[model samples]
Every structure is written in C-alpha cells, then in structure tokens.
Target chain A: MAQATLDIPANKIWGGGTSPFGASYGKLMMWFFLLSDAFSFSSLLVALGYARHVHADTWPLVENVFFHFPLTHAHLPLLYVGLMTFILIISSVTMVLAVDAGHTNNKKGVIFWLGLTVVGGLVFLGSQAWEWYTFIVGGEGVVKSIIVDGEVQKVLVQGANLQNNEYGHTLFANFFFFITGFHGFHVFSGVVINAIVLYQATQGVFERRGHYEMVEKAGLYWHFVDLVWVFVFTFFYLL
Target chain B: MNHVEDQSLHYSRPHSRTPEESKAVRKKILVVTGLLSLITVVEILIGVYFSKTHVGEGTWTLIKWFYIILTLVKAGYIVLVFMHLGDENKSLRTTVLLPMVLVIYLIFIALFEGEVLIQYVQEFMK
Candidate 1:
C-alpha cells in the first residue's frame, strides 16, 4: 500500500477532492443512480419469481397467454411481444448513435438520431399499451370454479382483473401488470426525458456548454430501460 | 486556481475523433446492433418453437437456461458497448457492477424460500 501510494504523482492522488473515477460528477452520479434502480427492478423480478414458484402448478403457460397479434385471426404466440422487443432494441441503437454523434460534436447528427430514438420509444410504448389491452380483455372465456350460494360451482369467467383471471392463475396477471407496468412507466419517462433533451439540443444548450454530456447521460438511462426489458421479456414471456 | 481562465486545459472542448476512429465507432455500433437483434430472434424462435416441440423435461430445462444465458449476453453488450460502461475506468466499472452481485443472492433466496413455502403449504395448510 505504501509503495503504491508513493508511486502515484501528487495530482493523481485521490485525497478526497478529485474525480477518481475519471468521469464527470454528473456521470458518476447517474451510474450510481442506475445501480440503485437496477436493485429496485431486481427485487420486483425476484418477487415475481417467488410468486410464480409458489403457484407453479397453477401458473399459466406464458406463450399461450400472449399469442394474439394485431389485425390477425390466427393464433400467433410470442409474435407481438417479439416485435415489441425489437422496437426497444432499435431505439437503444439509435440512442447510442445519438451519443456517438454527440461525441463528434455533430449537432445535426444528434438531432436526427435522437428524433428517431424518440419515435422508437413512442412506438414501443404504444405496442405495450396494445399488449396490456389484450391482456386485460383476455381471449375466450373459460369455466372456473367459484363459490356461489355457499357451494362451489363452475362459472364462466372472462378476461383478467385484480380479483380473478381467466388465465391459469390470478398471480399471473398480477405479476404481468406490476412488472410490465413498472417497466412501461420507465419507458414513458425515458421518452419524456429524451424529448426534453432533444428540445434542449435544438435550443443549443449542450452546444453552448461545449459538450454533449447531457445526451450521453440520457443515453445511459435509455439503455438501462432497455436492459430491464430484456430481463422482463425473458422471465415473463419466454420463460 | 484560475481554472476558469486557463484555456490550455481545454476542459470545455467536445471530443474530436479521427476519420478512422469514427469509422471504427460506427462499425462497432452496427455490429453490436446486429448481434443484439440476432440474439433476440434466436430467443424468440426457441421460445415459440422449442417450448412446444422440445422432447422432454430435461431438454426444456436446458432451453430455459439457454434463454437466461442469452439474455445475460444481450444485457452485457448493452451495458458494456451501448451504454459505454466498457469505456469507463476500472474503478467506476467496479463501483457500478459490484453491487449487482447481490441480485444473485436475492434470486437464490427467493426461489428457495418459495419452494420451501409451497412444500409447507402442501403439508400443513392443505
């Protein structure tokens, strides 16, 4: 430890007053904040796994539950969700492009890429809304056992709600809503943030500051949102 | 310290890359994009097809683990390449990634307790 400390130059020493991470304060804070956010998302997914495990016998097969496609009569399992995944991935690419353009101080490039990214985000959010609608409305009604007049009787149930689900188990719908709702909210906020950043870029905020760090920061967030969705898609739909 | 007046530091200048470097960056971005897309396609195909057609429970379990591993690969690329965490200093990278290790613990405990609880419910509550 003494030799290592002595090998460092005076200016390089992190004596409680320097950016030891070689990053701007804002960027470092953004990373830490994202780390914390990752924990929150992890816990939520963990809870979903726990609940699914406890009710493993009754848990619905996810592919069967999410097979519907827009403007189609045929049953297509995992098609719509797959499309949504592609949409988010494409947006993440555009976001990284925007950050790359920012690195080169290319304002027009940043605007173009950022604009595309915003559109991609909106499209993904719209797709998610459609998915949620299909989920809440469900498909064909199924007969389920329910207590009626102090006796258990088979009754036809439709769709999904907090109380019950036409799907295999109620927890299935609950977890779907909670996990995807949380992720959807993140995408919504990411879009809003990207739009604001786009406006700021147009108004020459980052250009005047002589750096596009804000875009890079927002790009980090957008990528994090996409990252979370990757897990959600696997655990919720694919698994 | 006159840090504000010193233009020699060039602290406010935007990063400039050579033409070759720019080309490399663009190529890397495109490659990562293609890789991510391909992995997603493979995942979808496996989920949609193999989940229905896979022969046995062992094979199905293998496919599930494959799905998880592929998802992690995709995630690593996003964080490391797209998010540029790969370019950050080692200290910063460690600071960000170390805490995520706890998530493995969380997953293990939750699933274990779930199995135990379900068994308990079967034995007692039922």
Candidate 2:
C-alpha cells in the first residue's frame, strides 16, 4: 500500500510541486497578500458596522451628508458617488482587457488599455480629493453651540474632525476618513505599479521572458481594489 | 554568441489563441462587465426607491438585507471572472477562499459582542 501510494505522481497528490496549486510563486504570493489585506479591510468595516449599530438612532444619513452636486446648489443624493463607482468599474473592465491582450502578446493592445486604466485611476484620485475637500469644507447653515460672553449661542459649525463634525457622530467622519483614505492610498500605489508595468511592457521585458505574467499579477491587484470598493460602497453609501 | 542568445530570447513563442477563441474571451469579458453593471444599477435603484418611500420597519430591514446580498453577489462575480479564480484549479481556489471563512466568523462575533456592549452601556446608564 505504501509503495502504491508512492507510485502516484506528486502533482496528482498536491496539485503540483513547489506551486501545489498550478499558480506561479508570484501569483500565489499576491493572493496571500490580498487575503491579509482583505482581513484588515473587513475588520475596519465591521468596526464601522458596530459604530452604526450603537448609534442607530442618531447616525447621520448618507443621503443627507453627501447631497451636494457639482456646479449646482441642488441636492443630488448619491449621484456623484454613483458616477465615481461607474468610473472605477469601467476602469476595471479596461484592466481586464489589458490582461487579455497580455495573454495574446499584443503589446500595443496592452499599452492602450493600460494607458486608459492609468487615466481612470488618476480621474478617480482627483474625484476623491475633491470629495475630501468638500467633506472638510462641509455645508452652510449648520449650527453648533458656542460660548459667547458666558452665554451659549448657536453658531454655524463647518468641517469635521475627531472631536466635532457637521454630521451626527464624530465616529462617522473618523471611519470615513480612515477607510476611504486607506483605499485611496491603494489606488495611488496601484496606478504607480501599473505605470511601471506599462513601461516594462513597452521595453519588451515580458516578451523577452515569453510571458506577460507581470501584467496578470497587476491585473489581480486592480481587480481586488475594485472588489473592496464594491463592499465599501454598499456599506458606506447604499446601506 | 550574444546575437545568437538575443535571437533565442526574442523568438520564444508565447501562448497565442486563435481569433475565434479571442473573440469568445472578449464576449465573456463583456458579459461579466454587463452583469456587474446591472447589479450595481439595481442596487442604486432600490436604495433610491426606499429612501423616497416611507416603508414599514420590517420592509426597510429587508431592503438592507437585499443591499448586502447584492453587494456580495457582485463581489463574488468579480473575484470569479475578473480575477480568474473560476478558471483556477480546485486546490488554488480553496487556498484563496477557505481563509475567508475566518474573516466572516470574526465579523459575526464582533457585531454580536458589540451589540451586547451597547446593551450593557444602556443598562448602566439607567
């Protein structure tokens, strides 16, 4: 029985040698890193969930907080965020195209799609910066109590911080800043990595190696970022 | 000798699918993108509808559940198609997905314990 078991191929027993799962070393490593990152993000979101649960009665409504529209005084609840989500999703589509092109060794196709992806990322980052600024600047006519000549007077309170916010609870802004800021940082680094990979592709580095696995790895990271955003959008905005 | 080595490096054949196969792949990608976009649009519509309407407490809770389910569906589809996890071997898929169970458990416990703490605080105040 032991001899018969030994006769079976190692690949048959353990997927494959060294890789053990048919994935290359780098791809497997990327998956592990993503899994760890996922844990961190999930924990943060869960913490946010706890906060929301505790403050269920007084938690600021997402629609009321994010109501401003671009270049208009009209309140467009979730319109801008919807646009941002669409842009990110479209960028993810372009990234898939780039990876598909890589599979076929189409350098020009990869370059074009990758360029579009980078542009999409930059657009998203710009939109996020504007959003953060808007959040900090806050809305007009929001009032908080102020001590004036030993008398408490109601005055407009703007912006947000750890201690004070125009929103209902300071925890809301805290989580928003922390979670979205962390995600934005990921997008920034992803764009940088994409640019580097694009440069390498142009130089025929992957072609020289007879594979575009680098592009595929980068694509995995991009998709993971988009995946995380889906959850964030649901938890923070939709729910 | 250097020229010979360079030629060898340049001439190695990468995997090349035929035009028909490539077209199929493109179609699959489009389908996945369409599905994801559709789910997102539905989610947005539901959110807008519920916000505009004064639904019962039970109905509101149901809608929130819908949002969470839809989000998970979208996330699952992306991981399966765009990340190519669906095409990967069983062992590889398991390696990537199995650990996620722990995270889910963590979330459940955190929420439960957090609720308990909230109740405790409320009682203490009374």
Candidate 3:
C-alpha cells in the first residue's frame, strides 16, 4: 500500500500515469527555471566583481557614488540602497503573507498582502529610478572620458573608461547603470505580474478551482528577484 | 490491522492538512524576516565603518572574505526561510541545490584567478 501511494507514478497528463516525480509538475519546473536564472545572474555579478578588481584604482567608490538626500549635499553612500533593500525585504514579507493566505483560502488576506507587496515593489522601483537619476545626471554632469595610458583622461574617446573620470573611469557608471537597471527591470516586471495575479485572485479566479498554484509560482518569482538583489547588494553596493 | 492497512493509512494525504496552521508558520517567518534584516544591516555596517579604518596589513583581504561570508549567510537564510527550501525534503533540496554548490566552487576558482591577476596588476601600480 505504501509503495502504491508513494508510486505517485507518472502524471497521466504526460501520458505516464504519474507526475514523473512528487510535487506539482509545474512548480518543479519553475524551480529548475529559477536555478538557471540564478546562474545567469551570478555570472553577470561575478564579471562585475572581476572588473571591479581589475579597475580598483579607477572604480568609483560606491558609498560616495550613490546618493540619498538626507545624507549628502551631493553624493552619499548606501542610504538609498539601504532603503531599497528594506523595501525589497518588506515586499518579500508581504509576498509570503500572500502565499499564506492562498494556502489558508483567505481571499481578502491574499488581496491585501498582494496589494502591499506590489506597493513595496513600486517603492523599490522608485528608489532605483532615483539612483539611476543620480547616475545619469552626475554632480559634475556625465563626464565622457576614457582611460589613456593608465591615467583617466576626461575626453569622450573610444575604448576609454567612462566609469572613472579624471576622477575615475566612466566605464564604472556604464556597468553600474546596466547591471542595476537590468535588475530593476526584473523587479518591475515581477510587480506587474504580481498585480495581475492579485487582481485575478480578488475576482475569485483561482479560489473556485480550489487550488493556489498561481500564488506559489508568483512567490517563486518574487523570491528569485530578492535573491538576485542579494548578489547585487554584495558585489555592487557593499564591495 | 496488518502492515497493509497501516501502510495505506500512513500513505494517504491527511484529510486535514488544509487548514494551514498559518499562525505558527507566520510567526516563524516573521522571526526569520527580522533576523534577516538585522543581519543585513550589521553586514553593511561592518562594510561601511570597518573598511575605511586602518587596521593591520591584510585586513582588507580578511574583511573582504568576512563580507562575502555574511552575504552567504543572508543567502542561506533567504533560501531556507523565505523560499521554504529548508523544510523541504532533503533529497529534493539536494537535487535542486547541487547546482548551486557547483556554481560556488566555480566562483571560488574564478575569484582566485581574478585575484591573482589583480595582484600582478597592482604590483605595477607603484
């Protein structure tokens, strides 16, 4: 009897008479998908770390690079990022609550938590926008420069580092914008999708079916977004 | 009752797991969340204040590893607590997480490669 039950055999949907494994087939695949995404993000971050190491002298100091109004007249370190981090963490919390509500069949709780999660996501995106604004519109304005013979030259030339100006390379800003912007895009998309799910859920979409895989899947995506932020925070902001 | 009856009863999905003891799980998750936030702040503080202070030579190297470890700790917590990977069955977790272990090993090798090359570059800085 135990063998028969454990045999969950191949899921008949696949014509195998069982799911090929335990647990929801779709969710298992989502986990696999996330694993691949994690690798891709890690590769990008590792490259950033390598570049930072190779350009140590020319890399813009991040603490001094990022801005937050209350801290610095011009460039403050880590304050905006800290806020963003908190917002993301809070969003993750709300997402968990949403999942909990889904599990417990609480439609109202699901909507509320999902709504809060989306709001937190928006806040994080707003923080990213401010961060990007500071980057694009630098204190001295965008210094189009290039590295010349080991010294940073302040002229818009080909193959030169824009991250560091006469102060540092300009390539630093390029990477910073590209990497963070990409992650911000992920957060933005996640928020949109989450809102859609929440909206559908509020309309009693998944509740009648007596299942909550949508919430679980959305939670998976949210966790991935948060996970990527950890790498970004460690390599880009902290390092 | 023979083994078959016992086995049948044990294998069946409990008619009742549905009323999610959400209250307990909620409390557990909140505690985990608070701990996660605190650790992140502490890690950042260490990076901010200690990195600038002039300690003995090689402190930067030590601190670099320290920061990385702390970040790893954060990652572990997020995976285990927030992602529900912790309570998952060990076999499933291993199947899913094995890739991550391999990636970290590769990252370790990559770090050494970059570090060695950077040291060579820094030698010419003076």
Candidate 4:
C-alpha cells in the first residue's frame, strides 16, 4: 500500500498521539515550504501596502494609470487586469485537472491539461509584459513645448506618475518590475516542472510506483501560484 | 467517510472521482467560486460608492475594514479547500498558518513606520 495518510484527529495533537497524516513526510515538509514562501510574498506585498498608505492622497488612479491599450489610442479601465485574473483562474482549473489525471494514470489527459496550463501561463506572462510596457512608455506626463509661430512642438517626458515619482524617482516602478518579475520567473519555472511531469506521465513512470507523490508536490506548487495571485489581485489591481 | 468509502481505489482514464464524490467536490468548488465572485462584486461596489457619495468616515472605515477581512477570508478559503490544507495534520496546518499571524504584525508596524517617516520627510523638505 502506498502510505494513505489522513489527518491527525484534533483531540490527539496535545495528548502525544502520533498524527495520522504525519505518516507522510513529504507532505509535512511541503507544508513548511509553502509557509515560508508565503511569508516572502507577504513581505513584499506588505511593503507595497505601506508605501501606498503613505502616498495614497496623491496616488494616481490605478486603473487610469494601467489602462492604455497596447499599440492603440484607446484606454479602458479594468480591461487587462480582468484578463489576467481570468487567465490565472483558468490555469488553476487546468492544473487541478492535471492533478486528477495524474492520479488516474491517464497519460493523455494529463498531457493535454498540462499543456493547456503552460499555454495559459505564457499568455498571462505576455499580458503582464504589455502592462509593464505601457507603464514605462505611455505613462502620463506634461512637457514644456517650443512652438515656431502658431504651432506647438515638444518632447513629452512622463511626469510624476506613480511609476515615475514614488520610490525615489520611481522605486515603485523598479520594485514592481523586480518583485513581479521574480514571481513571473516562478511561473515560468512551474511550467517547466509541469512539462517534465507530463513527460513522465507519458512514459508511465509512476504506474510502477503505485503512488502519485510527484503530482501532489506539483499540486502544492501550482496552488501556491494561484494563492499568490489572489493577494496580487487584491493589492495590485483591486485596491 | 467510512473505511470502504475512503479506501484508495485504482482509477484510470477520465478521472471522475466516483459520481457521488464528484458531486461533493464540484459542490465545494462551486460554493467557493460563488463566494469569490461575491467578494469581487462587493469590492467594485465599495469603490464606486466611495467615489460617488463621499460617505461618512465611519462608513468608509468600515468598508476598508470589510475589504481587508474579506480579502483574508478569500485567501483562507483558497488555501484550505483548494490547496487541500484542510486535510492535513494539525501540526502541519499550524506550521503553514502560524507564520501568517506574524505577517499581520509586520504589516501594522510597516504602516506606522511609513506614516511617521513620510511626515518627518515632509517637514525636512520644508
């Protein structure tokens, strides 16, 4: 039998009883890892909230700042963010399906869903890039114009927008790029991990072992990605 | 919930957890999704209302507090139910949640420090 551990009954924790779920060492360690990773993310977001609090009175409207359409003259609020959120939610669903398929030894099902998840992840990253580009390039600003006679001419320099002003001449933008960039890297890495698992599934690797510990581990990671997005959605977009 | 009901069964192909199990899990997912959408709608409403009415500080404060609480609730649900932490051992569960308590403390202190620092800087620039 493949160590089918369940929860440690509630009453037994204080009374020196061995935890039922304690039988699975990998699972317990995964829980610890998730806790630490969650903290690092929370630290970054908390700093963001602190900074936002100090500057809220002058903070540019978030939607207005983030809404410029890529390579177009139109702007719409909550457009890209809604798309990003939808992508993440969809990817989470696909990942759950992959986990389910892995447990069933359904190689084709696992590959299909895992592939879809990778695609979803790539799309989300692309959207984030577009959002970042707009902030960096099309950012709002007014510049002094030099006119000949009746015409006005000037080079527009993005002014004191949130991306340009706060964080010591836009440390906000710097940190935004750095933190979210790091997170996106995690997503990219997760996609690779999923690909490897898909390949293993195709080879019928886990069938011999009779347990899907690999799937459980990957599920922990994929769920963490989804979990991080919830906070990112709240702090970065919703607020 | 019994021995037979919870017994590990080898399954292949489409991966439907027995039909009854499927219904149970689907029900759980749907309920969580419903709560999530409700929270999102509430967020949109609060943002709109604040922009329009310039409501009382008491009301505004309450809304802010509400937003924070709901944010925590949504985060908790995703972790517990979807992440399967709800099925874990007690010690393991605490290991995941206890550090979160410290994060709350850090956020409070950061807010205070940020306010005081901003005030001092403004005075200095004067």
Q: In the order shown, what is each candidate's alpha-carbon RMSD?
A: 2.9, 4.0, 6.6, 7.8
Cα lDDT for residue B1, candidate 3? 45
At residue B26, candidate 1 shows an lDDT of: 91
DockQ of each candidate's interface versus the true one? 0.62, 0.45, 0.28, 0.31
| Local accuracy of candidate 4 as per-residue lDDT tens digits, A64-159 | 566565567775656566667667767876777666666556667777988888788888889888877666665446553535467876635563
Q: What TM-score does the predicted chain A of each candidate obtain versus native chain A? A: 0.93, 0.91, 0.82, 0.78
Superposed by TM-score, candidate 1 places the C-alpha of residue B67 at a distance from the truth, in angstroms, of 0.7
Better of 1 and 2 by lDDT: 1
Question: Taking chain A of candidate 1, what TM-score results?
Answer: 0.93
Error of model 3, residue B8, in angstroms: 22
Residues A29-121 of candidate 3: C-alpha lDDT, one tens digit per residue = 778988888887888787777777667776766666664554458544575687688889889989988877776667888899999999999
Worst 10 residues of 2 chain B by lDDT: B3-12
DockQ of 3: 0.28
lDDT of 2 at A233: 93
Chain B TM-scores per candidate, in order, are 0.86, 0.83, 0.65, 0.75
Candidate 1 runs further than 4 Å off? A1-5, A9-12, A147-154, B1-13, B52-54
Kindly state the number of residue pairs that clash in model 1: 0
For model 2, how does the per-residue alpha-carbon lDDT over B1-126 read when each residue is reduced to its tens digit? 453233222322346898899899999999989998898888877776678247887898899888898888999889999999998888889988999999788878878988898999899999
TM-score of 4: 0.78
Q: How accurate is candidate 2 locally (lDDT)?
A: 0.85
Question: On residues A132-153, what C-alpha lDDT tens digit does candidate 2 reach at each position?
Answer: 8888888763687857888998
Among these predicted structures, which one has the highest TM-score? 1
